[model samples]
Target: MEFHEPVMVREVLSVLRPGPLSRVVDGTLGTAGHALEFARLIGSQGILVGLDRDPAMLAIGARRLNEAKGKDGPRLHLVARPYEEICEVLQDAGMTEGVDAILLDLGVNSLQLENPERGFAFSKEGPLDGRFNTEAQATTMADLVNNASERELADWLRDYADERLARPIARRIAARRALAPLRTTTELAELVREAYPPAQRFGRIHPATRTFQALRIAVNDEMGSVERGLKACMSALAPGGVLASISFHSIEDRITKRIFQGATDAKPDPSNPYSATTTEGLEFELPFRRPIACTAEEAESNPRARSAKLRAIRRMEVTS
Candidate 1:
């Protein structure tokens, strides 16, 4: 897999300001980019715990960290697990009281997206399997497209996958599946592309991009997982500890912004869901009243970071 440049590296480091005696937990250590930076910031007196659900990624991250020099080198602790179980993982490590900071860069990793064999991209030709971990019991993208009824597929696309033309695409997929099951990325992409006119397919980007995104999100429960993971990560922060999250879509960003603003007692108005809530009733406090995005320079350098919305919160007090 090609090395993926970590998006918004400077912003992540700034939000997760580390120092000696601090311990940082990187809940989604894809290539250990953030973990390495966090470890270096915290120094030799501090520790860094890196976690990922994919053992393949964990292996690569371990090698990367091991080869690093100075502070980031051996102070790194690696774990192969999902970010949702962050609380449990920390407790098992005897660090449950929390750590100095926590960072979660949500969505698909570059490693996963670039590898066609991983089936995360329609641009690549591979099996329809989109499981973050091949060992996971969850059904792959293929199972949903091949076995689901037209109504089921449509609902998935409209609700979970957020495809605007979900109904029509689902109808086309169902019709195609009757002749042969959709087993590969190209097969499914072609079906979605076929549902559109040639002009639509030849647009700025493939029309199937959004449809593919919706399917991956559905298959992985990406949005739901972000909600649960954010809460868990906030709960795992030490007093005055920081938690930073980078969300790639509005659905994820809305949740992150609301949670951060509410936790900080900085909710905008009655329209804000947790405007009336108090810190005594919640987990943490937001350090920023609004979500922050990448700078023009960062966006220009990394187009993927353009859609990214970053929000941060700090633990005021540790709950019993």
Candidate 2:
């Protein structure tokens, strides 16, 4: 299977320049597409830590790195854990001081979406299991769809996917599951299509697109992970280190923007609520005022690149 080329490789490399002997982390390793590039840049003297919740992906990543790096390359520490637990990963790797650079490629990758068995795509026929870490005993998409109350379903649909027909969709799902459980991607997708107004059923995207996206997000707790993972990455950066994040949707971008802004923005004085002061210790600075977008050429070649947004920040040296 061909994993999609890592999005905005040029932009990501530009923002995160991992030099020889540098320590770097690819928080969302995927198939090691970005991690391979990082390995090449950091060289054999560097240390590369790759984290992924999926053992399958981590196995693939390790193989790819091993095959590509040969006998002489960065020391590899591929961990089967979530990026939100970076502090522990770093400490275990003996880098408690921090890494020189970190990369967080957020949202589902082509590997997961392409595999029908993983059930990440609305276009495919597969079980309603969308957990990123399939090995974990966490709630699956089927669990939520089959068991969640109508109100709960609607809330998740609206909050996670911005689905305009969330209530109707939830009602339809609740009604259908009462008779027989919605067990497959196509089953749920068709139901969502039926829930939409005839006119809206076929628009710029499939009627089931939002519902599937919302379900995957809810099943994986993606937004919460992104929030925690970004914060962990920021905290794990050594002085003068950089953290770059690539978000596929508005909500992920918003969370990244908020976290990065909070770190860089001036703080309100604790002693005087009315006064704002520059934070007195180590701080962060935005390398770019605006998020970076893929080139039109790249977007044409890789459709997924169209929605990709890259944001980066650097930790400043200690300042009293």
Candidate 3:
């Protein structure tokens, strides 16, 4: 199967200027698109470690990398682990602080959604499975919809998706599940669609888009993973090394913003109510205060690129 094109390719390459001898990490190597580019840039002398939680993605990434120049290509290290486990994987590979740069294109891969079996697309008729790693024992969207209390469901919808009609949607889900369990994507999507009025469905996008995004985020722990993975990337990179991340949603973007902003200096206090000394420690400066996005032309070519926001930071010092 052809993989979805990686978003913000130019920005990623610009942030991670991997030389022929540099070692780079593609922490969220979904389709190996970025990994392949890194391998090509680094040539045979450099090492490109590709990590992903999905076994299928890891297999595909390995095959893609292996097929390209093989013995003459950069040393390919493909790991089936979440990006949060970067430090452990790097240690296992004896890389230590040997990395030159790291990239994390966060959120679900388009390939997963396009494949009916993966169950990521609400438009597709498939199981409600949303786990990045099939081995993960976490509760799926099916379990959430079928088992959670209406109140709990409402809270999740409102908090995660910022949905105004969360209460009604939760009630509808509870009522529907009582008739029968929600086992598939289409079933859940239908219930959510029913929650909206007919006029709302005529809008620019599907009404169930936010709800599906929220469910997937909750099931996969996307925000938590991004925060933890950012820290791991910072720890794994060599001094002066760069770290770049592409977040597609507001929640992920907020986390990236806070982390990148804090890394620049001592974290600001929101609890003290009143505080002085805004200027602080470690010089983790954001190369771009505002995230860089794809051009309109690129977005036209790749619709997925429209939502991608690339944020990069330069590591100045190791925390003592």
Candidate 4:
């Protein structure tokens, strides 16, 4: 899909299990694709908080939300900042009791991937600026590729993207960047393609995909945000409230799973970053131990839904 098509909307709503006239938060409000649905679910008097780091996307989401809202639909409280600021936004909105539901769709939106200028897709040619919040003064892919040390690049690639060819790719990037800075996405993509062996270069996923993902995650501090954002979102949820998050990749899913179960996995692994296990925290209880996956039918229609792993938990009511 060219637009910001939300994956597993029905599944998300089902997992959230929002109550009527309750408050909800669409933490990654790309184009209000999901927020619009949440607005409907909450009724006119309910509150639907929308958040996005990208001003461009927040505007689009706001517009879509406004257009979809019924006369008595939930009020839209859209904010422009990383989802990590979830609690701050809610507190500022004077939400004393917290919210009843929260949905965090942690996928790279089509609004970004399809737009070459955002530099998220390897198939397209564009600048190497892959910051989700384009207006933020954050490090860009170009900055990381050009300035980060060879060892640092390799570690980052391996840690963030689980890229097997991280060492070789980092070496090549370091060498080439020394000659001339890699200013564009194509430049980095081409470098990665050359860095990969012929057998893997022609694989289903492009050679540069992992590197791009890694750089984007690094520039945006996505994993860190997820860590902090989850806690913030949970803290902002009322007792018995539900928090549903859709993780797009393995590492993120692992962290999300681990955190929800109330354990911390801080050690970094170079070979397999996602393999971290721990015990329970007891703040929230998983409705289902297994994460919900998109059905084959849904996966076929929406390619983005294929890798999505939906996990949800309800905050246990505080007892003395």
Using all chains and alpha carbons, the TM-scores for the candidates as numbered come to: 0.91, 0.93, 0.91, 0.91
lDDT of each: 0.80, 0.87, 0.82, 0.83
Candidate 1 lDDT, 178-265, residue by residue in tens: 8988899988888898888677877887878877787888788788788778778877887888989988888888888876666665
For every model shown, the clashing-pair count is: 1, 1, 0, 2
User: Which 10-residue span in candidate 2 carries the lowest summed lDDT?
Assistant: 271-280
- The number of clashing residue pairs in model 1 is 1
In candidate 1, residue 139 scores what lDDT? 89
Q: Candidates ranked by lDDT, best first?
A: 2, 4, 3, 1
Q: Which residue pairs clash in candidate 2?
A: 44-73
Give candidate 1 misplaced runs (Cα > 4 Å).
69-74, 159-162, 265-283, 317-320
Runs with alpha carbons beyond 4 Å of true place in candidate 3: 202-204, 266-268, 271-283, 317-320
Tens-digit lDDT track of model 2 for 216-295: 98888888898778878888989989999999989899878777776776765354422222223558899997999999
Estimate the TM-score for candidate 1. Answer: 0.91
Error of 3 at 235 (Å): 0.9
| Candidate 4: tens digits of C-alpha lDDT, residues 1-320 | 54587889999888886656889998999988888888877887798999998888889999888888869788778899778888789889998798889999995788888888888877878989988877675788899889989998998899988999899999999889779999888888988999987887788888888898888888888888887787778777788888899999887898788777652224534444322322233356778878899999999998889999999878788899
Q: After superposition, how far is residue 107 of candidate 3 from its true place, in Å?
A: 0.7
Could you tell which candidate, 2 or 4, scores higher by lDDT? 2
The candidate 3 region of ten consecutive residues with least summed lDDT is 273-282
